[model samples]
Target: MSQTITQETQTPTVPAAHEAPPRGGKLAGRVAFVTGGTRGIGAAISQALARQGATVASGYAGKTERAQDFLHDLQSAWAGHETEFSIHQGNIGNPEDCRRTIAEVIEKHGRLDILVNNAGITRDRVVSKMSDDDWQQVIDVNLSGAFYLSQAALKHMLERGTGRIVNVSSVIGEMGNIGQANYAASKAGLFGLTKTLAREAAFQLARDGKLDDDTIGVTVNAVTPGYVLTEMVQGVPDKVLDKIKGNIPVHRLARPSEIARVVHFLCADESGFITGQVWGVNGGQDM
Candidate 1:
């Protein structure tokens, strides 16, 4: 069904999940760590969290100049709010670097409340042609990087008795695409990691067979975004891109902010019971 807005009502906010309900600022005074958050979808997530009053630690793998520009834009965008932003420039795929990134965030923020594993790279190649290095690189960053960050942040969240872990998966993981064997595999690994880790955390926080509200548990979930208009999609030829859009019922690719909103919602305080699930922000494409 299609609908239109008239003067009687205004259009709803596209990224409604940026709001945290029951309080003036939904995530007021909290802390968030967003990896690969300097551009594209990750940047959107970082900004959304910051707008909701969470001090955001934005992580990026490279490009010092761009990181500075991103930080400036982020700060400028949220100047009205008392949101603090910092850039952690390092390759999260590097285990040691991942530790240092989380350490800096905790040291500055004094505590860590949310971890969004949005750091990922694509080494698209057919299975027969994909090099070992390409496969290894994607897995190392998309999978192990999340593991490393979550392991480091979980320690603090456990001590505080609450936390949120949102890993950015992909629709390709669900419906494997041509020349994306490595990418799909890496993302599928995220979904597996998400569910298993959620259950493990849940069991650790279990009391009398029920999750304790006072000390309930940390939640782990994955978001699968399809054909989002980001740098990653620029390689697709216009003809192919149009074909992809034609396949999607919505007739267009998803916006980065739309995916960010889903990630933001998963990290909200009210989304405790919504763990271990894969929310597809594909605009009716996958369904």
Candidate 2:
């Protein structure tokens, strides 16, 4: 007699061992690369992204001890969340370093979904007093570094047809702070770079037949934060700091986390349509 096959007799289907289990949070399975990610605002941005379930590759130029401490804290805080964190040492000003940083992240994580060009330096001096080296150094690290990293990340992002790039500019770039000419110019350059790259990303994708209504789009944006309470600002004298705060309508310096919030929003997967925009998080300081 032939026996009828039953549902219980069939083998139950199971997820492949190689497949990653589904994770919670908006950025689950996504990877983010943050420059200068061990200190100040950069550190805040790294934490924000990791909290949302993204694997983070934080780049630092120097300060091994600081980066180690940050990595330890991050891993401890994110333990059991299925999130991974890493710190990479590299000078963002070097194109080769920038390219290698991106390559390392891709190799280790298998993908890069977001890029934050947050590494920057300030050579505070008036044009007449600013030495050539000072100007060049600031420009190299602040403006050119962003370009280098963005250029490297763009190739992969475009091919995948999805990505987010957020440039961290400053209010000094817009208002022109005294003794910060080089810094201002470099930051201002980012505005132009951000807008142009935004257009190019879309154009290239369309040309490659990757553009469509249903596709998760690639976007580039800039966030210009006003005076923030970071090490960069803490050095200012109490009287000067008070004066600066008085100018802000909010009457206080911004927390690094506040700036990170804007970045986190811009990098969200749903923020694809919000490209080439300059978000001023200055507590009405600019307007």
lDDT of each: 0.77, 0.81
lDDT for each residue of candidate 2 in 42-124, tens digit (9 for 90 to 100): 88788778767789998888868867877877776665668998989898789899999999999999999999999887666
For model 1, how does the per-residue alpha-carbon lDDT over 142-252 read when each residue is reduced to its tens digit? 889999998888777766778999999888788877787777887889999999888877876664344655543699999988777665555557777788788889999
Q: Per-candidate TM vs. native?
A: 0.87, 0.90
Worst 10-residue lDDT window for candidate 2 reads 1-10
Clashing pairs in 1: none
Candidate 2 ranges with C-alpha deviation above 4 Å: 1-24, 231-234
**What's the distance in Å from true for residue 66, model 2?**
1.5
- Give the Cα error of residue 51 in candidate 1, in Å: 1.5
Lowest lDDT block of 10, candidate 1 = 1-10
